[model samples]
Target: MPVPGGSGREFNYPDVGAGRDDVSPAGYRSLEMVRELGTGDQIFDAASRRLFGWQMHRAAGIRLARSTPPPAPGVDVRLEWGVGPIRASAWCRVVDVVDEPDRRGFAYGTLAGHPESGEETFLVERDTDARVTARITAFSRPARWYTRLAGPLGRLVQRRITQRYLDGIADDQW
Candidate 1:
C-alpha cells in the first residue's frame, strides 16, 4: 500500500539508507547502540529471526500494527505506540537487507506520518569466536510537532526501546 502523504517511491528523509553507512547526514541526530547478546551461533540465529520477524519490536513494547512478514526491500510497516485510547502511529518502508554468512539485518526509512524523518537499522552479527552482538544504528530528526516538543525525552524513549530490543533477543525464551 502507498504511504499516506508520501510519494510511495521516496522516503521522507533525504539520506535514505544512511543508517547502513559509517556517517549519518548532517543536521540529524545520529545514534549507534551495541550490545553483546551472548555467544554461539544459536543466539545469533535467534536474534536475527526476532529482528526480521517483527518480534523485536513487539519485545520493545511497540505494537506492529501492520507489516510484511520477513522484511524485504520496499516492504512497508506501520508501528503504533501509546496506551489505551491514545495512540501514535508511524510508517516506514524497508530500504535494505543484509543477509551474509556472519551478519543479518535490515534498514528502514521513515514514511509520511512518522514522527521522525530518518532511517533505522537492526543487525545481528557473529564473530569467529562465537560471540554474538546486536546493533542498532539510526539517524533522525523530529518530523512532527509532538516529537520536537518532547526533545530529550524522545531520545530517552528511543534508547529504552533499543535496550528492550537487545534484551528481548538475549532472552532465549522466545
Candidate 2:
C-alpha cells in the first residue's frame, strides 16, 4: 500500500500512532513497528489474574505476578499467526503507566510482548472511558526472492485475520 503524500513508507506516524514529533520520534517508530507486527491493545487486571487480548491476533495467555502488582516480569506470553505450530514468546510491561486522563472509570497499561518474531506490543489507550477500539497489524517479510512474491498475499491474509479478531474486541474492551 502507498503511504499518504506518496512517502511510500509502510510506517505511518499518525495512522498507527506512536509517532510523536514532541518526543522519541525514532523510539516511537520502533515501538509502533512492534505493534504494527502484532497486538497493540492489552489489559491486565491484577486482581483478576487473567491476561486478556489473546483472543485477538498476537494475543496470548500469560501468568502475572501477584506479589509484584500488575504487569510484572516473568509473565509468559504466546503469540502466533497462520495456524501452524509457529508461535513467539515474550512478556509485558507497563512502560508508560498512567491514570485515566479524562477521569472516567478504568486505568490502563501498554503491555509490550515479543513472540520471538522480533518484538510486539498491545496499546490500550483508555480504560476509564467506554469508547475504545483495537487492531492488530502484524508484519513479516518473506525469505528469498521467490518468497517475496507472496508479500501481497501475506498482507491480504493479515488484514482479513485482523479484522475478524477486531470484531471480538469491543469499544469498552480496548
Q: Give the number of the best model, judged by TM-score.
A: 1
Cα TM-score per model: 0.90, 0.36
Candidate 2 global lDDT? 0.30
Kindly list the per-residue Cα lDDT of model 1 for residues 15-57, writing each as its tens digit: 8777777588999998888999888877888888888888888
Q: Which stretches of candidate 1 lie over 4 Å from their true place?
A: 1-10, 65-67
Q: Let me know the TM-score candidate 1 reaches against the reference structure.
A: 0.90
The per-candidate count of clashes, in order, stands at 0, 10
For residue 23, model 1's alpha carbon misses the true position, in angstroms, by 1.1
**In model 2, what is the error at residue 126, expressed in angstroms?**
3.6
lDDT of each: 0.83, 0.30
* Alpha-carbon runs more than 4 Å astray in model 2: 1-53, 58-76, 80-120, 127-130, 135-140, 143-149, 171-174
